[model samples]
Target: MSAEKIDLLNFLQAHPPFDQLPQQALEQAASNMDVAYYKAGSQIVELGQLLDTWHVIRSGSVEVYRRSGELYNRLSEGGYFGEVSLLQNRPSRFPVIALEDCLIYLLPKAVFSELFDSYEYFSDVVEVEDRSRLRHSVSQREDANQLMTASVKVLLTPNVLSITETATAHQAAIKMSENGISCLLITDLQSQICGIVTNTDLRDRLLTPGLALDTPVNQIMSPRVFSVEHNQQVFEAMLLMLRHNVHHLPVLKQGSAIGIITLPDIIRYETQNSLFVVSSIFKAQTLDELVSLKADVRACFVRMVREDANSRMIGGAMAVIGRSFKQRLLELGEAQLGPAPVEYCFVAMGSMAREEQLIVTDQDNAFIFDDNYQPSLHGEYFAQLGKFVCDGLAACGYSYCTGEIMASNPKWRQPLKVWQQYFSQWIDQPTPEFLLNAAIFFDLQPVYGKSGLVKQLNQLIRYKAKANSRFLACMARNAILRTPPLGFFREFVMEKDGKQSNSINIKRRGTAPLVDMIRVHALAIGSKAHNSFERLDDIIESKLLPNGRAEDLRDALELISIVRIKYQAQDLELENEPDNNIEPEALSAFERKNLKDAFQIVSDAQKFLRFKYQPGRAS
Candidate 1:
């Protein structure tokens, strides 16, 4: 190979679009390319310049800016520069200028067309972009910090080793020896967090003091818990343990104890290079690499389920990793087109924004920029970021919301004042459409940029809703629409649909009803735990649900969660579909019975909510 061809070939083997090309084809691509170098601040493509070549940065970065002097995006090494011009076959809308001394591989339009025609995968990047309409508004992010988990089946331990909070000190010790662990968590009768006893506590407190074996476990169990949510990285778990000077921590969902995490468990989960990509995602230089790391994310979830990881732990970890990816994507976007004169915070609205994502989820996002942004200065920057994030997420395996709730919608990306106006209008005149499905907005959490903005807005929402009886009633009435699945005879009801269409609809009938009910309760109480589980806990404390009812609802929610998890695991195993649906026929009689009772409990709560909110008649 010629010297130029050899250098270009090596470069192609490393970058995407060409990285997917086979060796011989890549060589042909390299041989067909011409190389060019640019000095800092040099213009590679001027505005009104006719379409020419597709330029790839082999080294250094280029800033794509409008001739009107507005900065567009920063494309660095291994990034393509003139795609816009090459794509439309017209004058460049954005001029490409070298931000630093740069090495660029210039592929003429003819050669690129030939390559695209030959290689099928080469067309995906464009196809993915062209078809991805909701993609142009949100900036993508990547940050890799790992807590260990399995990428394959992990060894699960059994023998039902656990201790009751009422168990005596002697029983705790005996159980520890029997199970061979230094630490044991005290589970309450309700299966919530109670306390923990380490082997050190066992030896130091019991043996040292010669305490009676019959003393309650709670008496000696050190209650200083440094816990993490489930599915949180083992690294985060380790850090929490280290910071709290605790050896064990309990993981909770909706304020109920779910599992335990320890330093040793951390070490075991991330065994065999699990931490490598977990750490590398943040260091990725290009968007392509971020897309690649997401594959590992799917692998982690698959592995977590295979290990029989509880839903709380699995969801917690996935939330963290998903946040990391988006955070990184945002960082890259901001670095490329941010620090603008105006303040803009990217809001992840649905699963992502709320730090709750299922294995197969849809994107929900919106932008809240400072109202003072001068159109001439910040519009393009925010626009580009919105586009990048929405698009990048789709590439990372989150299907675009069919409902078009993404930040890419110009209607959603607006100034904070505008957002307030939007919410105020939506709240004041809560229509059936808003009530039926708009709770996704209620679960809003700031995932990136200016969390204070989200905080301020949340405060306003509480202030507005607390006194707006009509609005509250509307929300509550809507919340009760999905009444618990109690039958006329109060029997456990399953889906009427058989094999093919049958599904218990855990998310819809079970979790969402309770979740929405809790949201209304939270609005009344102004609770900060927007999540259904956490919000329910707050409701329990607020005395909204009668003590007995609260207890029942908690158990119902837990059962729903546990049921969802088992189904999810089975789905992964079959490599069938991964969804929230549960077939009624698949359930054991006990499960079906329990699910029905759970459904009834939620339905009762729904009735209470509807009565409280009186649909048409009011006091």
Candidate 2:
């Protein structure tokens, strides 16, 4: 071969199919690829060619178009066209024309077949594209289906197109004219979505009696509503909707409308198989099994990040997993240790305890044993049980309680009297260590045993916190110390040295501080929500944060959580390391800015809390 041929072969051989193929086979295949160049506006993959050439863009832009009346958008470099030929065994879905002077590497269909006979990787490449297209088609079908489902979360699915029941007859007519929806569901305060108001409703109710377009929907809305449960399959739901001659079917779960899923979300999640893993975890049997399910969960984390799973679903799924771990661990512990003689409760003290932990963080647990009787031999049996169960948990990859906060630690595994005494002392007089301890303990979720103990403990904590707001304010000030690891202008605050050098401490500085702040607020208000997001919502609802600023705070914190999960996923790929510190530089400008806003919210909330109950002011 000529030197130019040699250089071109070297490049092609290093790229994809060649990289995977046998060296000699790759060299042989490289000889057949035509080095073609075209000027701007030249047709590359003509509309209905015999599909002879499969081209990968080497330089410049390629515009793939269907006969949509005019030129479509141009695709940039690295965007390959002609996958339809390889995957679908058909001609190009659209014509591809160059938008700029372009260089292309053409792999002829004949050469692909010839190369395929010798190259397994070449086939693998083709398979990935085919599967991806199928996946996309599947996703679109899912999206359209989910759009008809109902939800209190979002009145409609992620698709912006939706119609409301209360929407006027005239408005429905206008909406149908513009967007082509036959109907829309009317949602109530309970968010129970039902009753489709179609274009027919407009004609029968408004146009018939010379009625006004502004007529209330309740007058003419179809009371005989056809509906499907949110959990039902999209095809099943579609069939129900179609069978009833209803274009809109309100979706329900436990009588609360979560969202109006048309035919979309179901199809999307099903095709993706990323979120599919999350639903599977609901059926997990044991802690070891839950631990085994980690790979799937981490896969979900990666998929969600890549697929851009909505913040709510992503955060909600994480909280579900964290709770699942706690619940399973508690069940296992209960089975192994047997029921305590005293009324006792297992508490999740840190992230797992907070119900806001992102992905796979280490577990933090402790016990509150009832001490109604001064059981003479209580100490030995309970301590031994704590050790046995906690050790069993460690064997399942929870890691030992890093802070020894588990029931295995005598101090943490305290009697109810001792816990109450400790709480009284800490809240009455907050110290740095005490504040830290309170931050953890206060966020506890009673996973097993007597939740009443945890409840009573919270009741006492909240009452005392309100009575002595000064102590709570000091706790808030301490909570602010961790601040969101953001610098002067919204840059990530990085570690100066050590293994996590140049990384953001997501647990401590990023998420945990917000966790602490929310715990304090919840305690102050005596809110029943043990989770961070829920507590934030409670605070917002109670007007605790001054005109829904808590919403902003919650959003900011959620962004931290998303980043934490993403970081965890990255670390998992890098030797399955537990992800904690996130590299701030890895974040986008929008995310970095959001992190800064989140930290500022924490700082501001802490300051306001302090101002409300600072030592001098409190007295």
Q: Counting only residues 3 or more apart in sequence or on different chains, how many pairs clash (N, Cα, C under 3 Å) in candidate 1?
A: 29
lDDT of 1 at 335: 84
Residue 119's C-alpha lDDT in candidate 1? 73
RMSD of 1: 30.1
| lDDT of each residue in 1-619, candidate 1, tens digit only | 5786777777788877787677877877777778889998898898888866888888887777766764555566677866656767778877888877898888889888777778766765554333222121221212222233221113222222467888899888888888777778777898755678889887788878998878888888887656654334455566777777776666653364555556676555553222444566678888898888765776577665554444555556666666666777888887888565677777776555444456767787787887786657677777788788889888877678888887778777788887788778767778876654457787778878788888878888888877788888888777776765566987545567756354567787787777677778888888887656677778888997666676677667767876887787678768777788877778865576667767878888877777777755422
Q: Candidate 2 lDDT, tens digit per residue, 1-619?
A: 7996787667766665455566677666667778789998788877666577778666677666665523333455444567566646776667888767888888777777677666555665565444433433334232222323322233245332344656666676776678656666666655555566766777777788898878776667787876665445455665675687665556654465444554444444343343455445445566556567666666555555554444445555555555555556555555666765667777776666554555565667887887762447577667776776576556545678677777788888787888999999888878777876787777666767788888888888778877776787777677667766657865566888888898878777867777777777787788877767788878887787777578767766776777777767677667677667777678764456556766777667667766655634423
Q: Which residues of candidate 2, in runs, are more than 4 Å off?
A: 1-297, 300-339, 373-376, 489-492, 574-576, 615-619
- Each candidate: RMSD: 30.1, 21.9
Output candidate 2 Cα RMSD. 21.9
lDDT of 1: 0.70
Q: How many pairs of residues collide in model 2?
A: 32
